[model samples]
Target: MNYRLLWAGAISGLALHLAGLGWDVYRHSRDVTLAQREDVLSLANPSHLMIVAGTAIMAACLLGIAVTWMNERRFGGEGAFGGLLRGAGLPAVGIAAAGSIWLASRADSSGHVHDASHSHGPQQAIVLDLPLARAVGNETAARFVASSGGHTHASAGSFGADAAMGEGSAHHHHAEVPVTAEQLEAAAAFVARLRTAIAPYEDIRRAMADGYLQITQDLPGIAAHFIRLDYRNDGREMDPERPEVLLYTKRLDGTWRLVGAMFLAEGVTEEPPSYFGPLDAWHYHENLCFVGSGVRTVASREQCPGAFTARTPWQLHVWTVPTAGGVFAHDMPEIDPGAFPGAVLPAAQELRAQAR
Candidate 1:
């Protein structure tokens, strides 16, 4: 048996193991969400496979070395007890192999748990006329209070339910009384002022020049969001002239059209103001994971990378363009690429129906 060959194989396997470990670390740091979502710790991961292969090769090489040494000792007139002691290497290898298999099984089981915990279900929207404080049952409110570490709010019960149900659901209470004609007139007047203020942003270049940077790509049924970070935290709540974000959609001809404006409250803890009286229903996002140039809702805090689980500030959308959800809808409707500039887009419900 050539001991030199075994030593060389052992060193090569160690090198591969080290390289794989380093690669795994780098991937986790740079792409944490993707790595976790893809379960990079599993055997299917290239780095994990390399590590396993390297360990197997190194173990085989060591076993071969041990066997060769035992053979040499046995043929050289070694005592039976000495030969038996040397043969312990075989059992040692077997034990190590069993331990490795056990660890691998544990890892696979954990991967299954991770996948189950991160699974997302379809979102359901529930509308209520009563405030969240009164809408939820006493038991639900108690549970919410316990989960929130004794924090209490009129809307906390509803928010807790929303968190459990996952994202894409808006829970807001309409005023008990119907919106009066005067309130509608005032809202229309506010909308007129807002439209005039953002009229210059019809050209997307002007919006970009005015510190509105695009935050999201074009969503299939939703317009892209462009935000001015400074305006978001300026302590201005529902300033028509200084909206926190602008909504835009790309036309079929490649031109960008202004669609709507989003008004954000100054803080997450602050109660959402009814700018348009009962017509405006503000909503916030919780457990949203934000990676570079992307944001998504996760089922659990563990799924959110970088510990970005802070609830978003309450926000309301006011569409200047025609939409089925009206001017002050929580969500924007689907825009038609081939439609004229002032054309009304299909309602969000209509789009969902068409998709189904």
Candidate 2:
């Protein structure tokens, strides 16, 4: 008939649950704000929200044990058996807490890992221009190569002119680099393996925590909300087939679809895979300022004090989506809005606008 013990335990459990829920909400809010790109928030997705709920439940159970022990002391029921039970629960609670922490950390790292909108000083970065005339063994052929090298953002009103001129001049340089049969074979083999190894969200979820995919960054201002997959931190050597990052474009319909893959190797002397060679544009992002809302590119490492420095792996995008930028262009501003399967461009635009 000792109702005090029961009441105390119930109150403690409820309070702990509420406290944990509050903490989780605060954490998620902060994380969402720091979510690198506008579209990359963690709690915005259902999969990540579930992890937050589970943590609250575990916290309630853990605090409930503490209340039961306190009541045992108050009632002078601290016998050998009572003591044993109380002690036993502590270890179980500890194990459960550990597991919960692991799951929580996994969720955070996987979703936020790609938000490298933060900068990394160019410790290992080697910035190289694209379309370096690798295939043009003779000087005559090299003269035709468009020497623009990297992307130059246009003023707000100049997007159309910039894109048009780029297509007129740079298009041939991007596409005309003839692929040798051997190089084509190598690229095809690598793409096949990548396709087989990773899928949309499900299989990618597994690879996110494993050694496969370890970094992600949102390429803001592109036509499609594009996220770059990276592997510089995966703690393993990367091969040609295992690209530095897999590119995914978010449809206006709130679904993420695979658009391309990027291959990058560290070190200044390192060259891209034979498949990429000099045909594809390889680019890197150097110093960037990361804020709670998004990332801003800076001129130099000194420009952004205390900001993270991100030295990118040399990159080549293999666009699978029907992009205005040819299949091998680094990025495309002219993505066909209506091209995504199962999504009407107008509806997607409305929905994505609301989502933002």
User: Which candidate has the highest TM-score of all?
Assistant: 1
Per-residue lDDT over 233-261 for candidate 1, one digit per residue giving the tens place of the 0 to 100 score:
88677888899998876532334678788
Top-lDDT structure, candidate number: 1
- What is the Cα root-mean-square deviation between model 1 and the actual structure? 16.2
* Candidate 1 backbone clash number: 0
Q: How close is candidate 1 to the true structure, as a TM-score?
A: 0.44
Residue-wise C-alpha lDDT for candidate 2, range 122-221, written one tens digit per residue: 1111111224322221222222111123333222222212122365556421223344545444444554455554554323334345444322323432
Q: Which stretches of candidate 2 lie over 4 Å from their true place?
A: 1-178, 200-204, 207-230, 233-241, 269-276, 290-294, 300-307, 333-356
Clashing pairs in 2: 114-216, 119-308, 119-309, 119-310, 120-308, 120-309, 120-310, 121-309, 229-245
